[model samples]
Target: MSTTVWIILAGALVTYLTRIGGDLVLSRFERIHPRVEAALNAVPAAVLTTLVAPVATTGGVAEAASLVVAGVMYLRGGGLMTGFVAGAVVLVALRNLVG
Candidate 1:
């Protein structure tokens, strides 16, 4: 009814169409190439880096320390939840101590 609602619906429709289109095209192939699969697998990490890089760069010491702890946990084979919990703990502790 509203312009904002129309815009949101259009965006959702476009997103759905693109996703379905990609699935349809990929489904025709018997097997995906290793390189293509690797690239697809890397997409999440690339997107995450894009999302976090700016915050990490501009954030304070507490944020930096938390991110470092989270990264260490990940490198040590911790699960995503573990890394997030560890980072949250570090961030809260540091903010309390620093502020």
Candidate 2:
């Protein structure tokens, strides 16, 4: 309906296509090169950094604190889901209290 909606839909479509394309291409290969496998393994962390770094840089204290909490949680072996939930709780609590 709106430009933002169209952009979101387009992004979703592209993301889906890229995921399926990657799977298809990898399936055709009998064995992946060690370098290629290492690069693929690094993709998730790279993507996460790209997504978080911009927001953490430009956001307010609440956002920054949430990111710090999440990072610490992960570093302390809290696991992904626990880190995410902890960050989300901090974000919501700070936003509500500060605002």
Candidate 3:
């Protein structure tokens, strides 16, 4: 196999292993509490925030504005896709204006 093929296989194996590990751990607990469920649901957004925060902080005005718009839209109960679109539009407009 080529290097790319080998890398892809390794990544797939790692992903599968992680999923199995999580399932194994969760299998011990038949039912998680409502609060735990809520926290679990928030994990994706929390991770996304962590990923974006550093870039937004270090980036120019447009990046910061985009982050603010995305966050506001999300907090206002907009769907994830809507929040992404709103942030992207703001970022594009700001970049065109300032860049």
The model with the greatest TM-score is 1
Off by over 4 Å in 3: 30-42
Residue pairs of candidate 2 with colliding backbone atoms: none
Model 3 agreement with the true structure over 20-52: per-residue lDDT tens digits: 996688779989989988988998989887987
**Which candidate leads the pack in lDDT?**
1
Q: Relative to the true structure, how large is the alpha-carbon lDDT of every model?
A: 0.94, 0.93, 0.91
Worst 10-residue lDDT window for candidate 3 reads 48-57
* lDDT tens per residue, model 2, 1-99: 999999999999999999799898899999999999999999999998898789789989889999999989989998999999999999999999996
TM accuracy, model 3: 0.70
Tell me each candidate's TM-score: 0.74, 0.69, 0.70
What lDDT tens digits, residue by residue, belong to model 1 across residues 12-80? Answer: 999999889978898899999999999989988998899999999998999999999999998899989
Error of 2 at 23 (Å): 2.1
> Candidates ranked by lDDT, best first?
1, 2, 3
Candidate 1 has its poorest 10 consecutive residues by lDDT at: 18-27
Error of 3 at 79 (Å): 3.7
lDDT, candidate 1, equals 0.94
